[model samples]
Target: MTATTPPAVSMLAPARPRRPRAARVLLAAACAAVFLWPVVMVAVGAFRTSLPGTPGGWTVTKLVDTYLSPVTYQVLAQTVFFAVSVTVVSTLLALFFAWVVARTDTPLRRLVTPMMGLVLAMPPLFFAISWGMLGNQRVGLLNTVYQWLTGAGHGFFNVESWFGLILVSSLKAASFSYFLLLGPFLTMDRSLEEASLTAGAGRARTFFRVQLPLLTPAISGAAFLTMLAFLEAFDIPEIIGIPAGIRVLPTQIYSHINATYGGQYAEASSLAMCLMLIILALVAVRARLLGGREFTTVSGKSYRLERWKLGRARWLGTGGILGYGLLALVLPLAQLYLGSLQSLFGRYDGFSLDNYAAVLDDAEITGAIRDTALLAVLGGLVTVVVCTGLAAVLRTRGGLAERLVTISVWMPMALPGIVLGLGIMWSFLSVPGLNQLYATIWILLVGLFIGAVPVGMRAAEGALAQIPRDLEEAARIGGASRVRAFAGVVVPLIVPSLLSGWLLVAIMISGNLAIPVLLASPTSQTVSVEVLKLYQSGEISQAAAVFCVISTAMAAVGVVVGVVRAVLSRRTLLRGTG
Candidate 1:
């Protein structure tokens, strides 16, 4: 018995290997610096009495002065008002459409999902431009049509007003909420509704008590996101608000930066800081609201989804869905295409191919097209790679390093693109050797990368969550190095999601104007910036033409990606079965 003192160590026992803590700490610190450097630069600028390029002394006078201005409060109030209005309208419309398509047996239900993708692919900037062409009071297609049908002396529509701004913004915002809410709507437990019905609740009452309550988290989350979107929105406010004498925080910041006699950098920085604080507050509130409870509906248990039958009202539901498509998608695109064919200011003298011809012939337009394509591809690749790495590390690790990395990746979500652009500009210009990147395409790439990485991280995290850790563990246990195990076991499983995330980021980058406006140099201009210049310079049809080309390209890409995804999925299913 005394000789049995030492037992043989089992080779199968789990190993508590010490990971490289120093490497993780360094990586997290680097990522945090990348994410927060611009923000810190912006804060420095906001507090400085002078601009970065000039001699500056640190002070809070700018911040105090901005707060003391009455116009600041007015703009803040209007921003809140616009954001709240858009959120409410978008959320209600999204709920209705999500319910109609996901819960009810609506006609063309198969088309609803793809159509929503198409709607989302069309950028909000394009929507603003299209609506501007459709409702410009004087030469707008809608106004022209209204005048023709009713024989009115004056046009009946004006997109430059608050009503028009809210309507267009709400329509765009609704598409996002629709996509976000659709998943939850489809996956929610039908047993809850059934139980309510059995307990003497009518259909409508059951929906309100059982179905809607279960969807509260989804609804609230979508609303908060939509609100932030509207708050940070630059295209809509810049395009529609300026002409209507409407000023929101984003547009106001734009005005400050683009003011005559070389813009006020300090003031712009102060405004950006204020906007950042507001967004941070909103984000904090959202986290607080969602932190306390679990909202998952799907589980290991098998459950059947029971689609509601609307009887004859199903046709009405179908009609409602089609109507939304008509308004949100078909109508604006049609107006854009038709308007692009018309002369400048959408003159109805006769349609011509001149706008398209000009777009093709213009060197700047061609250059912008090429530049946009490059930016989309390169920026998207970089974002995906960085985000995937960060996500993988965070998922596998724990403690302070992991937490730091998580916080760093998420910091961009609270910073608007405009603020990001401004901060990046300041950051590059402030440094000694780095100042060379200030006006180059690299700056724009950096800005877009920061803006898009957060989304990619979220997408990657969702994909990684579906994969089991045991696969990697098994490979490790089989004498495989950690790198080899990750490459062989993890990469293949997550490729589809990574590809999807990359495509999404590319599409978004191609359409983004906010970041480009503040960062792009003359030679580095993108299509969105070109479109804005054309519109601002009153080249209406040409702007429409450029927008039409870009939108068509994006739509075609969406279609191709969808088809490819379908084919790959089918092949995968076949392989599994075989």
Candidate 2:
């Protein structure tokens, strides 16, 4: 008898080959191309003397000229200066707080820990307005307080400088690093510290040698993420730096797109392209540096974490958290209230609720807030859905889908907001019959979805992979189809993760400045864009109030979502075990 495979076995293999690999590849590519359409357009426009009318007939001379500009060189120098300052300050601050919470026996670690995460969710515009309310030379509330305290004159505190920009960005951005470092510090094996102690190493020495080395991957990742944030910052630099005559690449790009002289689309496109290239280089360097490090901070091994007794320093840690929180959170909101109560800002004679009334009265104010909320919720939901699909494709074995999704995550992240906006304008707005989206709020929504999908998808994909395959198999054995098994068994398991992704996208969309700045029509402005308008027009108090409302609303939503999620999770676990 011939040793050939059975006809039934061969038939089974071809009938339903896993996921139709080609379809998966095609979906991944189509998704990637949708995201990349803007990026490709930007590259072409950046090199052309004028915006490209045809995709095939673009020129590279604009990019060449952009490199030759002395202003471009200066912008590069300023960008590096601000980025380095923010990185150093944020990393050190994050490291200090992380150590206090994770290693020391502090009185309020639980409260402080989640608060740090909350701070991380605050939009940069809020940070800028808060600082502006307290530090701006002409209208600073804190300057008034300082004069009262020290008998000093007003206009002494200038927030529109390079130092001010760096400090503000760092203070706000540090919370991300703190969140990143907290888990690693909590999960690290305490035995390493004990071994170092046995070798006669002191607490400080053990930290430098044993603990820091193990936390290297986490630190590197946190720093790189913060660096990217500092690099791409827009609203803070726009509001504060413009007044101070300090400009970074993002603000510079904004100027080219929206400032007085009919838009300098070519120069803006060039700057955006340069920013993307710089981001790519930084990410590449980080990946290379972290390649050799072991990233297994949380393994299956369980070890009791030893907490250091911080008897006296406990108060110090508590005080530090309180002070940072007040600086970033409390003080800003207070200043906003004081500012918004004034009928005419900078006038001490009259105190009234006219500013708040005025805010309610303005048609633009109401419209912007409504638009911002609707777009944020819609964009967040779409991001969660699309990202889940992308993540699923990525979790499977090596193939075109996996490779494309991985590349998509890293690539668009490098694309600057201004450049992405410009690309969208070209591909969707400039094209014949496509400019209709530009008229509707949907254009901004599309930009928000594209901007945040990669982030949401990555988070969802990671969460989805942790679900045990046995659950799905058991469902399948009960006569369920693959789709049914996923729907019945997998969806419920990953809902919490899905919600987290949605919350992130919502926060991002609410805080987003670039796309809305470029895409929002007068009728479709967002709160961030309104705040920017007020900032640009030098209406400090009104801007501060708007900033406070938007930021505070986001933080409140985050708290509500977190609480509901916790309650739901407990009920779910109880039901599963029952």
- In the range 188-219, model 1's lDDT, one tens digit per residue, is 87777777899999999998877777788899
Q: Name the regions of candidate 2 deviating beyond 4 angstroms.
A: 1-17, 51-58, 259-261, 295-302, 311-315, 548-571
User: What ranges in model 1 sit over 4 Å off?
Assistant: 1-10, 13-17, 294-302, 555-578
| Shift in Å, residue 520, candidate 2 | 1.3
TM-score of each: 0.93, 0.90
**What is the C-alpha lDDT profile of model 2 across 446-480, one tens digit per residue?**
88787887688777877788898778767766768
Per candidate, the number of residue pairs that clash is: 0, 0
State, as a TM-score between 0 and 1, how close model 2 is to the true structure. Answer: 0.90
Q: Local error of candidate 2 at 318, Å?
A: 3.6
Compared with the true structure, the alpha-carbon lDDT of candidate 1 equals 0.85
Candidate whose TM-score is highest: 1
| Candidate achieving the largest lDDT | 1
lDDT of 1 at 186: 87
